[model samples]
Target chain A: MGRIEERFTALKKEGRKTFVAYLTAGDPDLETTARLIPALEAAGVDIIEIGVPFSDPTADGPVIQAASQRALKRGATLAKILAMTASLRRTSGIPIVLFGYYNPILSYGPEKFAGEAAASGVDGILVVDLPPEEADELRCYTDPAGLAFITLIAPTTDPVRARKILRRATGFVYYISVTGVTGTAAPRADDVRSDVERLKRMTALPVAVGFGISTPGQAAAIAPLSDGIVVGSALVRLIGEKGTSDDLVPAATSFAGEIRRAIDAACPSQGKK
Target chain B: MIRTQPDRRGHFGIFGGRYAAETLMPALLELETAYRAARRDASFKKEFSFYLHEYAGRETPLYEARRLTETLGGAKIYLKREDMNHTGSHKINNTLGQVLLARRMGKKKVIAETGAGQHGVATATAAALFGMECRIFMGEEDIRRQAHNVFRMKILGAEVTPVDAGTATLKDAMNEAMRDWVSSVRDTFYVIGTTAGPHPYPVMVRDFQSVIGREARRQILKKEGRLPDLLIACVGGGSNALGLFYPFLADPAVAMTGVEAAGKGLDTALHAASITAGRVGVLHGNKTYLLQDEHGQVRDAYAIAAGLDYPGVGPEHAWLHATGRARYVSVTDEEAVEAFVALSRQEGITPALESAHAVAWAMKTAPAMAKDKIAIINLSGRGDKDAETIAESREEKE
Candidate 1:
């Protein structure tokens, strides 16, 4: 609670919106992803969310789901993902958050996961399907080990649920930008902005907007209202089209710079984007 | 004595094997070795017995059904009352032992699949007792029909995740639960609640449930002076029947009879009479007689008893049937109802509709045997839960 609160205050004082970039660890290739991660942090990503692929990802849309399949087919496992993070930890101290559903986490026992994630320089984890009510034991591992567990709050969540998430969540609260699966929509600028506004009244935890935000304008629009804007499929979609590691690195950085500029102007007093 | 040593490589004579996902192989092997070691150790059995008696409430009474027996007229009928076991049905016997095994193995979470919600309730009970997290996967339809059990599970601190793909019944729920088990075998114990599924589970669950037969053996010997002429019990996955009959297979004087629900009839599309109308194929991790199509789609089979309506019997039962160690028979819905009413009036015992099929078979068969000879039916569950369905179906039958 204290770390997340402190992070929010620091980011607010700096007047820089958080830039979160999510990518499947072994999506294109495990080795390629290892190189891609540090570059992402350098590209202005405040936090890196690396997805550990599973066979069934109920919450993700077709593009990310296909990427997960590709990752898993190349023998993408928890060990491989952990090994990738270990390699990336040499020089990178940027907060790394492992993201996936419960299956992979349960596959890798919780205590072992916390120890390894801490060893590999991972700061947090976000299980997409394990809601706040269900996340207590998972946090038992993370809290004792000093690893952050970022929790998600959906559009469907009522006030009580919002409070429950507020009480239960650690690290940063993931404010899903829309009603449904990831990568299925282009961002709705004002709706996301209002959702973030609604969340601010409830909790002091830093809110990072995720799900449908893609392109420079949407990121720029969301930046003003949020502590961070999480960009996932849009970047993965870019990598898929280019189909090469060489150009994708520079492209990711350029996109981050664009989103960063939006965050610069995205203050409460600055008015609407 | 129980057949403790299965084989060198976990096979029960080419029937059981650890053919699963690559990740699960190590965990399955570990479970096999631990189970073997635990059974051999004396202290483990002593503790299990203590829990079986104190915590789980074993050794349910065997009551004579005077009306049911006289109507059949073949032999005197008695019911080994498993329905009276704490938490209802024989499922708790296996779950308590398995949860203890899970703690011994140092696993902390419990996961299982249930169709009729009985197994789910039992697993949830064990999880609550051990103070371990529990998750049960049930079909979407079952979640609605067994909604009370769903609430019961949640109140007991187990999460009931509704599986909503394919047929969305027992088999599909099993598939979903297995998928979770394969990935998370280290942290969780997969508590299968029957004498079905793959290797070790069928054998393991049967052994836990052997309390049913062990108790019945003692009770029948004391009550009847000699073992009954025929030992009749219902076969769904064959846990209660196997628990009762398998121990007495060596007792040649006690003829073993397994009653399967005739369902609608022997007509392949209607009933759950697997041994009578099914072929040998691999389903639910065991090579056994199954009610499945050529392409391996599990067909919808019906029975008055929700528990006995499953399409596959345990492989060990198939072997027993093949080797002539046991005889298999089927009882229809109307006949089962008559037995239900007869037991309710004669002995004031409301047997589970599934267990009623066995009582029904006993009623029909006992009359033909010499009156001096005794017949015992495994009354696997009490009908307290079925008071509503029994009343309605009793009308539907009339």
Candidate 2:
């Protein structure tokens, strides 16, 4: 199994919910991003979604969009992000998913990107704009390279289409908790719970709820409803606010640690029958 | 015979596809189904025709510019007078069609993105006529540049939302509009102004605007006893160009040219010449030639004409360029300005700066061709809104 499937399987067996933390690569610079990876892992982050900044992030809200601009202005490219991943692989075995739009990957040459990304110890990739109908080109390469192609399921997705999307899905399903862009509005726990339950019945793949998830209270409320929760714009917003500080790593770790503790306390999956 | 393109899945030779957020996919699919049904429903066709003819003033003239031909001293030049449309541009053609579709789909709110504000004004006007809520997303830069159109949109009862992101131009406005659609998909209808965006949109907009080509084809045959030797139009997101070019795609003898805005020069980091100085990449939900950096980050496109300041071209234009069916060229801001003034003086017709790019290229090429050969420039919009910008530019030059 790939690292993504293996990680989910191991977590499921342990009766523990996962925490996926996202950070925009090269927000201030790659070195700070490198430092935050281990920091996030230390704070109980299960998977790391390194956002590859694009000039136009239409799917993101103001927080992530501003973070992307900062990263792009700092001269971050897909090549540098991959090199950072390769370097990070030397000391860490954390599952890393490169998250961004498709244009950068298309610019990198899909075949070459798939090969190099796999060689760089990347686990999966979630292209926000590429739906299953248009994913064949990138999947043809990433699938053979053992890289999981993470698919997003929106609230607007009808069940019939969801089933089709799930069938082709390899990695865990990313359930966008809201219909709007990331971090724009909070997802209601009641609304997310039923969707998570419905998704669980459809596929064996783990369902991770993301988008508009911020505070520990929200995380705690959502933790028991899904296999995992992705906190992106929240963490990205924090990093943007504290990136220039001397204690940026500590601040990020503590912030993520609060949400991790909240999830574990709320779910308490360990030792459950 | 019609030249079929965009197939059912909206692929124009692998250039156009539905590359959008998952939240918007269902809406796109819903739109496609509704559009397919509307295409077949005779009532929908009749209503669309009624609005085009009675409301938006269809059948704009195809007038011969004898003075322009004499000044250029070459091929006889004809002007396809899209400027005489009800809203002062060809944008009304697509807006009226989409607004009608929105009403048929039971949508009560309509939103659109505009750079030059022509599309925004068109959408606003249609919404007012239909009694629907209207909102327009315009870039901050464009809003400042095209204050006249912004005021027109406001006067038409549409809320103008300024997008402060990403160079504050048409691309940013489009991004903001898509974001709005994502959240408001249940009730709001996004009226894309150009022949870009995902499936159904490019095809739908092109279909609505193709009336220009159909009328020109018929009128040219009557006036010249044959088809024109060449057709010229400026390409922003390429709606006007495609409108005039789609009906003639199957004609082997007729030639077409799309002019892109080279803001300063192609060598500089500034031009909007996507097909001429761009690489094949995806943007605004369609795969096309885009102005992007080596790292695949989209570069901000610059043009004095706000309408032509987008970094990407329509996907079909990319396909047409790739297949060698149409030629694409670029004209600098200076050349466009010269043509803008020349057309005003020679023909007593003030062309929008966007359309002046086409006039500039025709001036260069038509002079080299035989006098008997004919060329038609799609005067995509009137320049009343651009009078201030032109005056300011002239002042700077002086």
- For each candidate, the DockQ is 0.02, 0.87
Chain B structural similarity (TM-score) per candidate: 0.93, 0.99
Residue pairs clashing in model 2 are none
Per-residue CA lDDT of candidate 1, range B215-284, in tens?
A: 8888888986777778889998888898888678778788898999887788647788889888665555
What TM-score does chain A of each model score against the native chain A? 0.91, 0.98
State interface RMSD in Å for all models: 14.5, 0.6
Cα lDDT of model 2 by residue, B181-298, tens digit? 8888999999999999999799999999999999999999998899989999999899999999999999988999999999889999989999999999988788999999888999
Cα deviation of A238 in candidate 2 (Å)? 0.6
* Position A74, candidate 2: lDDT: 90
Instruction: Estimate TM-scores for all models.
Output: 0.60, 0.99
- Which residue pairs collide, candidate 1? A224-A266, B72-B367, B73-B367, B74-B366, B74-B367, B74-B368, B74-B369, B75-B366, B83-B381, B83-B382
Each model's backbone clash number: 10, 0
In order, candidate lDDTs are: 0.76, 0.93
